[model samples]
Target: MDLEGLLGPQHPVAAAALISPAGVTVASRGADLDADFEIGSISKAVTGLLYADALERGEIRRESTLGELLPLGDVPAARVTLASLTQHRSGLPGLPRSARPLRRAIALWRHGTNPYGDNLEQLLTQARKVRVGRPRTRYSNFGFELLGHALAGAAGRSYGRLLHERVIDPLGLDHFYLPKAVDQLGPNALIGRNRRGEPRQPWTGEAIGPAGGIRSSVRGVARLVAALLDGSAAGIAALDPVAPFGKGARIGAGWITIEAEGRQITWHNGGTGGFRSWAGLDRDAGTGAVILSATSVSVDPFGLSLLTEHTRTVLNS
Candidate 1:
């Protein structure tokens, strides 16, 4: 499909896997998968799954208020719930405006200048000032970050530790972790470059790991998608057409739904610095694809179009 031409070889690494209800599977770029790309917002789906598991285990209630789980101190964050947080209807800004000088934000947190201890409080404060949208749809990273903090608080652990214990270990996804320090990142980690093709320094956000910081291999992501599509996981089930938000272009828990060329596709895309990734599962046909790139460009639309066209051809055959 000329993927290499479309996305430079140094910037593109694509993986696809087709799953069947009878447990049959086929994969490309599956065996040797890249494990160290910054997965961006796709981490939200994983975080959502963790929260779903917590709900199932009674560790936390989906309807539980944020204020009940953490110390919001006069902040209207109490009005937000786990569901709202995942759904991005928590009235939070996309991110803190003060976070412009990303390095300074990191320094402030490192020096313990802010006790909510990160930009999370700043996000919540912005949310309080804004109008909460209707419960169904809106995209906000601020809300997801709040959800991360709330989940960690409820579980009595740090966000990274909770993700490891509840999601990664259980799923046997050994290759993923939220980097505590930039130096801990692997040698193969993708470097972000600007549109001008200038290398950009590695940037870290304060305490917003849950919102968009998860790294994974192409095959590892496929396994997770397979589990979800087959309903093999305890708390996760395949996309239900009758769910609250319609099947396409909707957010359920953490997954984004899309209907492409007659296939019901549930997917998520993530990007950070010099890395971009797209992961999707076609529920009706029981197939999925994952694309991981070391560039900041939007590769999901192209990948999705290719996967959708290929799946259609096969189904017609």
Candidate 2:
């Protein structure tokens, strides 16, 4: 499928994987399939899966609220429903209010310092002050962060532990991990680069793990997609659309579904200070594709093209 040609020479290191009924095929430009790259907001999709899994286990319900799970006191965020959070209808802001959000942004741009290094306790502290608006489909990192922690609290475990026990371990996704700190990253983890080609620090924190702090290899991502395709993933139902998102889009738990070229594509894209990732699935065609790059550039067009193009090939084949 000319992965190299599609990726071009801009990316310093990138990996791609395509899965179909024909089986899985993976290719990389500068890194091996086992090399991990921060998947940014794709972490939300993983959290979405965990959210569904917890629901199925009777540990949490769609009606669950921040007040019912975490010690957020009687804040407005506490009244937000799990279902609202999953579908981005919780009315929480994209990020919890910061004392100096502009300073954080400038630091990230100039120095690539991690801005979301808050731990669980700090996260709860910030959440307690959040003022949730009326329920509507608005993407919110803060909401997902809270949702993931709430799920963990319900199961009496940490978010990382719950993720491992419920998803990674069960699927044997050894390369998939959530690093609560930079020290937890392994040697195989790639150092991401900003658009200017400068190396950036890895984004890691317990507070942000659920929203934008997952790392994985292309192989790990492909295997996860295969499970989702075969309905073996514990939270397969999370991919089902529950509410309308932006124009011409519907969102499920964390995944967004859209119609393109007459094909329904369920997908998510992520970007941090230095990394970018895209994953998409055409379930009816049993085809999926993922693109991960160490450079902070958009991979959505490539991922969508690969999946849709691959779907046609699979149908013809």
Candidate 3:
């Protein structure tokens, strides 16, 4: 497959790359393997890595709950297992009930307002008041926000610092970082664009960093992906499929695996007000790709197609 031709000049993605399992850059555009892009919900995978490492170190057990790590009390969701949070079966809503998401959605559609601004303290307070629904597989950014803090508290550090020490630095991913403030989203950070060509606000608030605030270049992501395949990452075991979620889908610590085209593809995609991202690898085929679109267009198909195509390339190479 023509990976470069696939990422033509007209694609909404400002920066993208195809990386080999040997940590070599196979193809790229708009930016090299080093420029930063907001990784969106891919941050959840980082949190998943932390959770897994914590378990390996005996810092926390797989079944550890928020209440055990923090002062979250007996809130139903607080008692959810770390594994459940990683797998998104914590029964926690996608957002805090206090968020009034219906209104937030309207605001986002009309004014492009960021729905997430609550600081860590406010988020924790809201989590205490949240009424979790029945136990089932439900994707929840709020649940991950809480899980990030809970893991940090247990480790006597902050989420950003823990992630740096445990995942980023160890993997030699120097380009990956959490944007702590608007200023942190500097020139290197790709400006996400709405459909109308208007720049969207950078998602940089502290409360949601663990869920969606990470920024990295395709190269950094490629390095991380390579590490995941090589077992060089301390938390690579987090990629193990542990719980079933949807038809032909299974959940790992922070990764999701789906059966497609006769291969089990482990992947995760992220989106924000203006940007979209897809990162995945086909272990059996030994190929992976990173698709980062500056516009909020879904790129899951492109990413998967790229991986499927890569399988053919590996066979021929």
Candidate 4:
């Protein structure tokens, strides 16, 4: 793949990296491999790995309910299963029902401020007012936020601490981190630009960190992809598909698996107000790829193309 060419047009900053049995390569524009960018909902993929780890450690069970972990009161969300939440079949809305989501979205679009800045207590209070719907393959930020905190509660640690202890530390992903506030951001963190070329504030908050608030450098995510491919990452089982997501796609913990170029590709894409990210794996070929962009445009096609090319090369060889 023409990695440099692909990143050249990305607004402000973008980074792409690929890893195979041969090694890892990174190409970027407007930033180095160590510059952090908000990874958006790819945080769910991290949470998914944590969930799998929790299960393996016997800290939680698939049948565990939200009420068993979080103090969500007597609400429908409290009764949802951990399994359903992990696979996004929990029937919860993408955001808390009580959070006035439309207003928050309007604020985000008009002001470019963080709409998901609610703290954990606020998140729990909002969850108490939620009404669960029929099980389906809907994506739910609300569900993941709750699931991550629940996992943390089960492990007797905060989400950030738990992530560091279980995943980041072991993987040696130096620039991977969850910043609960803007001040926590590193000096090298890249400020994202909206599609209109306007600068936007970083999306950071303890409540939403698990769903869309983690940040990482190209090197950090590339290292993670390498770990996932080599079975050295915790919760490798999270990559296994457990349910039908959309047409011709299956959902795992937070990973999505689809057949492309005659290969089963497992991947996830994320978007916040001003950033877009994609990560994918061609497990059979022992190859993985990631794309992080400052603009909110979708990079899914580029990421898939890279992975498919790697798979095709392996098959031909």
Best by TM-score: 2
Write candidate 3's Cα lDDT for 146-244 as tens digits. 888888988999888898889888888857888778777656777777767677777777789889989888778888888877778877777889889
Tens-digit lDDT track of model 1 for 1-317: 35555455445344444444544343333124454566788888888877887787788886898878777655566777888777776655566455444665474334322212255466556544554545655677767877887888888998888987876777776367776456767654555553445454454444667877676666567677777877765446313322344433666777778777666788888866556778787777766666666556777876687568656755676
- Show model 1 residue runs off by greater than 4 Å: 5-32, 98-136, 203-206, 237-248, 313-317
Task: Estimate every model's Cα lDDT from 0 to 1.
Answer: 0.65, 0.89, 0.80, 0.89
lDDT of 4 by residue, 102-190 (tens): 99899889988888888999999888888889998889999999999999999999999999999999999969999999899998888
Candidate 3 has a TM-score of: 0.93
Better by TM-score, candidate 4 or 3: 4
The TM-scores of all predictions, comma-separated, are 0.79, 0.98, 0.93, 0.97
Give model 1's clash tally: 2
Better of 2 and 3 by TM-score: 2
RMSD of each: 5.3, 1.1, 1.9, 1.2
Q: What is the lDDT of candidate 1?
A: 0.65
Q: How close is candidate 1 to the true structure, as a TM-score?
A: 0.79
lDDT per residue as tens, model 2, 1-317: 46668988778699999999778899887888789999999999999999988898999888989899999888887888988989988888887665255787899999999888889999888888877787777788888999999999999999999999988998998499999898999879999999889999899999999999899999999999999998878898899988899999999899999998998999999999999999999989999999999999898899999998889988997
Residue 141, model 2: lDDT of 84
Clashes in model 4: which pairs? none
Off by over 4 Å in 4: 315-317
